[model samples]
Target: MPVRDILQLGHPLLRAVAEPVADPSAPAIANLVTDLTDTVAHWRDTTGYGRAIAAPQIGELQRVILLRLPGRPVWPLINPSIIAHSPEKLVVWDACLSFLSIFMQVERYEWIRVRYQDQQGQWHEAHAGREDDLAELLQHEIDHLDGILSLDRMVDVKSLCSREEFERQFKANSPYGR
Candidate 1:
């Protein structure tokens, strides 16, 4: 598995709607999934935090997303789509691997239900509620597969803050802040 270079903003690949994986059990598809997992692991190890990685982000036009949930197993979603979304909205700070140095508040559903195929080509459904950051992360990566970026869903661009600023403010607002 190779650690593919992540495509940055302005790369045409990021804008193209990814093609569905025709054969999840195919060798090439399996390799791509392995590469994606390796890429996510590499990023997490290097940066100390990372949730998901999409094929487009790595210049692959295949609809594949790898998610690593906190305390859960690493999973792959092939050709995922949101089958249902909650009426309520939630604002979350989002940062992209492709768009480094910019963090923004994107509005997403409080809960989402998605359908996807596993590496073995089996279809499955998952539901994520408002309190589930893992669900939010999955949605974020799936957006990439659909040719959507966080910038497009930002509720207030001005509310965006640098990484340092976000951390500082978050900590300052905590109960520990004197």
Candidate 2:
């Protein structure tokens, strides 16, 4: 599979809710996972950021996302949803492959439990908490599947800043920088 172009922040498709994958093991879904993996890898290499990407980011209207933690292989989540989440919220800075130039501070669950299907169509549930980063990362990608962006989750209007500004003015205080 080839790396597909990512839909930018203003693309209408980015705002449209993605459809659920009818068959997790379908050939097309497998190919989509490959493309998402390849695309996110390429972006991460180029920008030194981007840990995951959603199908909708590549203009595919499907509820799918590929996550690649540092020094780890790509993991695909099909028809993923947050089955439960902690009542506690954490404020975190988020950036997206679709709009890497901007960084926003958003509030996400401190812990989450997600249910999803693997490429083999096997169902599984995973839990993530603050230390793992997956708590917010999964929330971010899942939001894309629902036509939401980090900008939509902004803690405050003042929380939006350019990447350069974030680095210059706030990196030292950011968890990502620490």
* Top model number, TM-score: 2
The residue-by-residue lDDT of candidate 2 on 1-178, one tens digit each, is 8889999989999999999888999999989988998898898788778788999999999999999888677899999999999999999999888898999899999999999999988999999897648899999999999999999999998888999998898877764563
lDDT of 1 by residue, 43-93 (tens): 877865567899999988999999875677888889899999888887877
What is the alpha-carbon lDDT of model 2 when measured against the actual structure? Answer: 0.90
**What residue runs in model 1 are displaced by over 4 Å at the alpha carbon?**
171-178
Please provide the root mean square deviation of candidate 1 (C-alpha atoms, Å): 3.2
* True lDDT of residue 94, candidate 2: 90
Q: How does model 1 fare in lDDT?
A: 0.82
